[model samples]
Target: MNHRPAEARQSPARTTEVGVRYAIVPVPVLSLETVARRTGLHPDLIRRFVALGLVDAGRDTSGRPVFAPTAPAALARVQRLRTGLCLNYASIGLVLDLLDRISLLEAALRRAGMRSDLPPWT
Candidate 1:
């Protein structure tokens, strides 16, 4: 599953250009191993994120997992949510579920010119 974020897929030349000003740097790609190293997590835990549908994988025909450049940072957040917040895996599942629902709602809210401070927002 070699998926890319919308902006990256849209522009191959520059990630995002500010008209004539400059281009926003696109994040780099990270393999699962690197993600583990960067996140200080066991490789098994990284795989669990994929199984848990927490992080999306990059484009790859092989079964190996490749992560987006931003994934290490994102996984770090999940790590905090687990360790710092003391949430168990089951709790994590529920929280993730709520977050997904909130994301869907937020898109609708944005289209309606309204916003709320909520889940996966920060």
Candidate 2:
């Protein structure tokens, strides 16, 4: 019943002369409709989030609201937090703002040669 090859049983990665190279793919800014499609949220929900300052959307050349390529994942996270934690939109917005602030502070600290030895919550 067990007929799997030895290679298949091991890790997927293998040594190669070419080596692995990671390329940073640019995510294009997308319209609200496109964002909604990507995030599986309604356009009206996105608009509400914009109004709440949850998402800072940029404008396209034609003055249409355009979201960053990462917006879908971010919006999905918000949705998860809302449903999983039963949090209101306002609370979610506050949490996101605080998270952003924390990230900025962490980056600044790292840049200043101050590494965090404390636990993550600290």
Candidate 3:
């Protein structure tokens, strides 16, 4: 008699139209405390960053803020901008916005086959 469950009987590999097989993997979510530990920042400071929109977070079932694995890196970037450029939190928001816009423009330029290094008049 077969005792294995139905899921165990099937192959784990998933195939796409191109015949490439892929395995599904779940992304790890971090809690606020974990993010704080990873970034070496106080939990209050991390909460302030979340309040200031410097980092993105989602609410868990208990109403606590949860973060993606990238939260630590984002917090580090904010810290770099703060200490390296001497920018305040409010100014950091503006700087981050401008940087994102620049990135998008650069990506568009690349997609259009234009060299970003060259001057526009060239």
Q: Name the candidate that leads on TM-score.
A: 3
Ranked by TM-score, the better of candidates 1 and 2 is: 2
Show the lowest summed lDDT stretch of 10 residues, model 1.
1-10
Shift in Å, residue 2, candidate 3: 54
* TM-score-based ranking: 3, 2, 1
lDDT (Cα) of model 3: 0.79
Clashing pairs in 2: none
Which tens-of-lDDT digit does each residue in 9-114 have in candidate 2? 2234545588863324443567999999888889999988877767667676789888766678778878987999999988887787777678879999889877
Better of 1 and 3 by lDDT: 3
Q: After superposition, how far is residue 17 of candidate 1 from its true place, in Å?
A: 32
Each model's lDDT comes to 0.67, 0.72, 0.79
Where model 3 places Cα greater than 4 Å from the true spot, the runs are: 1-27
Over the stretch 39-118, how does candidate 3's per-residue lDDT look in tens digits?
99999999888888777777777999888776788789899999999999988877877787799899999999999999
Compute the lDDT for candidate 1. 0.67
CA lDDT, candidate 1, residue 49? 75
